[model samples]
Target: MTELVRATSGRSEVALTFHGAGDLDITRQVLAALAQHGAYVTVLAVGTWLAARPDAAKMVLDGGHELGNHTWSHPALSAYKPEPMRVEIERCRDELVELTGSPGAFFRQSQGQHATAEELLEAGKAGYSRVLSYDIDSLDWRDPGPAAIRHAVAAASAGSVVSMHLGRPGTVIALPGILTDFARRGLTVVTASKLVS
Candidate 1:
């Protein structure tokens, strides 16, 4: 099957997913904002980041967010050969399993591009059912300020899977406004797994 970019469940719901691997302080801020709005997200975490801060797994899961593999070093997985690619995917999966008792439900590649055939194969080897992708991107990593980030995600609608980054303060700043906009539009924000389900 192809990578999932959006859900076709015919519901007025959207998923907010973040590229995980950032400062713990910023992550805490992002979680606090989401908690304030009673929203949940999926964090596709980098393995190096997880190794550096193993507590981050509990921090994310405890805040009602789930974790997924984004590879070991956040490199473009497609650039590597099959052996290294498998290592990247499985390494991150191992980290997740070690910390959270599971490899998570999805595998999202570094850089948030659509998964390649090789990526899907390696991901399957690592125990992922689907490669989670996104239809909308907030571009918060560019640090274009909160307004730009909000404007970018403002395009989300039902079935939209929005791509965001967790390591940036701009995302944390723009999150509440984005959630407010969704609330005003009568849309429900859900975790990626929920959106796909």
Candidate 2:
């Protein structure tokens, strides 16, 4: 498999990947914001969350965004043993397949930015050839102010996969301005797969 992070220097695409496990209403607003700017993103969803909100899969896909497995319960992959780790990856994989007919091209380990060695093994077994990690973290999940979240993500450049969250109110508030900044910099927001592809 290819290494996850790319060095596509001339590429204009910067991926805004949302760790999905939030209220349906919040996700709707996030999707609406993306729609307003004609941007696409990658949502790495937890299986338990996906199963709880069955409509979320289609909601994301319908917005021309991508959905990938983020694990079942979103525990730290490094803390899991082989069997449970395998289950964590595959269970979400199964949910994606059942809901969307295709498990997305990416898998991102939860509770961390980088993948664990064991997480990589489980991701491969679950048929994800690429694992998406981020270069910029918005830190919106911590309830930082919208300006602070905007400042954090405003650093995105070409080939950047910025980490953000769907459930974050600050993220929703900051997204429009962040998109404007990206547009100002000539950076196009695309799905993580598209950023590398």
Candidate 3:
């Protein structure tokens, strides 16, 4: 069985989730960071990105991370018709199954935005067990410096889900500090599944 870990006390455990695109460098950094802390991470990989970056995808699996569907491209599901969104979601799931050969049960909306709970229900019907969103956003995609990433993660509390990108240099530099800080605060870094379960 997977070891249980918690992000904070006095509440449901916090979740830290990462959304990854095709950028291997960023994904590698994130995986490395998680490994250093002896933790597993949740990765929502774009379907096309995974197809194009098999090496990186393998790296993530080898590092003991959980994979989730992030659609074929990073389209805002809210802006699309339900059929289109459903197609995208299924396509992502199929591609992930092909790449990792593991049945993934989580789906994260592209851009962290979904049209409604109905869309999430549709994903669930398609075999997704959870929909991920974040309470703490690193906003590293905005090119924030290391301090910004540090500050964002430091604000984490029990049950807070942090959003971060795999493609940011500042995030790489800030990862160690973030893990150490969480540990110092008596936070147990864990994968999203563990937190939610």
Candidate 4:
């Protein structure tokens, strides 16, 4: 199996990970916000986004960012059996391949849960080598306030994979600040592939 090349530069690095939750507006804002900084971003997109919002999917791909599968429907992988899990993963991958014209080589399992290594193998079989397992939990998934989001990223370090959601306003509001903070600390903000490559 081809292993996703992780960044071993030994310099302090961090990946700003965003899980795309069918939110085109948020994704657009994020891309625009990060472009000025030349930040490398990883966006995990759901299969439904392709059919329901192709425009959003196109926007993400057009940003020259790395896209990863987030499954057909956003559900915990631990909730389903192997066949169903495989189906979900593949469906998302195939849809992404069709839409973006690139087979998704990375994945971020729904809710960050994988019951076993077999699941990782399944991902590998589907041509996904890099899987994002977060290091910093922004808790933005819980609909927290901006202060909380700011506080969490402020504590990130090199190689830290920050979990964020485009669905949350707090996260969006906090992102610009986070990027500025990363700059102030002399750390390069990169994609998840950079962390585990």
Top-lDDT structure, candidate number: 1
Worst 10 residues of 2 by lDDT: 1-10
* Model 3 TM-score (2 dp): 0.88
lDDT of 3 at 177: 93
Give the higher-lDDT candidate: 3 or 4.
4
Give a tens-digit lDDT track for model 2, residues 1-197: 34465437678889999999988999999999999999999999999989999999999999999998899999878898988988999999999899889987788888888887777877888788888878888999888899999999987778888988998888899999999999999989998877876
Clashing pairs in 1: none
lDDT of candidates 1 onward, in order: 0.89, 0.88, 0.74, 0.75
What value of lDDT does candidate 1 attain over all alpha carbons?
A: 0.89
Candidate 2, residue 103: the lDDT equals 85
Per-model TM against the reference: 0.97, 0.96, 0.88, 0.89
Model 2, 126: alpha-carbon shift in Å? Answer: 1.5
Cα lDDT of model 1 by residue, 1-197, tens digit: 45899999998899999888889999999999889989988999999999999989999999998898899998878888988998999999999999999998789988646888888888887778799988898989899999999999999989999989978988988999999999999888889889888
Which residue segments of model 3 deviate by more than 4 Å?
Answer: 1-13, 113-115
Give me candidate 1's TM-score against the actual structure. Answer: 0.97
lDDT assessment of candidate 3: 0.74
| Model 3: per-residue Cα lDDT over 14-129, one tens digit each | 56667777468777777877888887778778888887887766887788777777788888776787788888888888888888786464777776533266667667766776
Q: 158 in model 4: Cα distance from truth in Å?
A: 0.8
Top-TM-score candidate index:
1
